[model samples]
Target: MTEADFAFLREYLRKRSGLSLGPEKRYLVESRLTPICRRFGIATLADLVGTLRLSREGPLERAVVEAMTTNETFFFRDRVPFDLFREVLLPKAIAARAPQRRLRIWSAAASTGQEPYSLAMMIHEAGAQLAGWQVEIVGTDLSTEVLEKARLGLYSHFEVQRGLPVQLLVKYFTQIGEQWRLNPAITGMVSFKPLNLLQPFEHLGQFDIVYCRNVLIYFDAPTKTDVLDRIAKVLTPDGAVLLGAAETVIGLTDSLVPDPQHRGLYRQTAVGRPAMTHRLAAGF
Candidate 1:
């Protein structure tokens, strides 16, 4: 790809998906878009760039964005986040909203449904604790393709093997041929939607817990700050936001502060912060 081709794609991706691609990622872009070019019958990267430039709202534009957005995820990824959820966040949220008997969770950038499904399983395991409560888990991603897969709640054997324990798999999944299908009871507990982090999210409503993990690293500093600001608007004042283990709010935004005891957990920084009476912050 020429300098101009790279420049156009970089700016286009940044504007469309808040992705900050540097010059070193030229090879990565080439590899990802080459298949897209062939699919569109375009002969070259420059030609694909021209086609995209002409029709910003075309199907090709969506294809390009989806191709570039990483959708890597699996059941109970990294372990600690889900551990913290079951042992800490869920209980606090339950008590915090006991009067309303409602619980809301947003799995921002949730890819292929594993993250939200894992949460659903945890809620199912809790059983009576959430018996009469109104629970909602909204899993949103920029890629419509992955959202469709998530809606189906089907995974290959390989997918199930990644971080999903054998006992839980046996308890929640039914074998279909060589694949595993999650029970509708669990899949019904979550809803999937198409969302762009660069856009407004007020329509999604406030949530007691928001998991915007591993998605912010793609954006530049300003975009990261802007996205965090929008997230703060839809998060309950005392709610928690769990970022990726490598991500943090320390130098990013003032609207949230890290939970001292939990590595990837954060709480809203507004006044009237909830007291840490329970040892919820002790492990994970």
Candidate 2:
């Protein structure tokens, strides 16, 4: 691709998906888009760019965005976040919503459903503690393709092997041919939808916890700040937002404050501030 074509792609991706690409990512763009070009039966990247320039919105535009957006994730990825969810975040949510007897969790940028499914598994294990609660896990991503797979609740051997404990695997999954199919008991806990974080999320309603892990690393500072601030709006006060281990709120936005004990956990600022005593005591 020439400079003009590459420039168009970079801007197109950034505007549609909030993906920030520097000049160095030219090769990465080429590698990912080449397959897109082939799939569409287009001859070259320039032709693909030409096709996009003419019809800016349609299946083609979505295909490009989904292709470029990274979907790398696994069950209980990084371990510690799930640990915090079980020992800390979930407990706080349970406590805060005790009067309502309802709980909602959002896995923003939830690639292939592992993160949300992991949460569901833990909730299931809680058994009596969560028995009467109306728990809902919403998993959203920019890619419908991945969302479809997540809806199916099926995993390849390699995928299941990544960060999944064998006991939970046996208890919650049934071997289907060579792949593992997650039981609907856990699968039913989550609902998947295609969402662009740049767009408003008020329609998703308030949540007890929001997991936007490993996602902001793709955007520039301005976009990252915008996304974080918007996230603050959808959270219930005292609601927590969990970012990727490498991502943080410092220098980006003041909508959230980091947890001293957890690497990726942050509480909503101002009214969303953590009620330390109330939060720690609600582990039931």
Best by lDDT: 1
For residue 269, model 1's alpha carbon misses the true position, in angstroms, by: 1.5
Cα lDDT tens digits, model 2, 22-87, are 999999999999999999899999999999998568887899999998999999999888899889
lDDT of 1 at 151: 98
Q: After superposition, how far is residue 135 of candidate 1 from its true place, in Å?
A: 0.4
Candidate 1, superposed: residue stretches over 4 Å from native: 271-284
- Residue 70 error for model 1, in Å? 0.7
TM-score for each candidate, following the candidate numbering = 0.94, 0.93
The segments of candidate 2 whose C-alpha lies over 4 angstroms from its true place after superposition are 271-284
- lDDT, candidate 1, 152-255, per-residue tens: 99999999999998998999999999999999999999999999999888778777899999999999999998888778767777788999988988787887
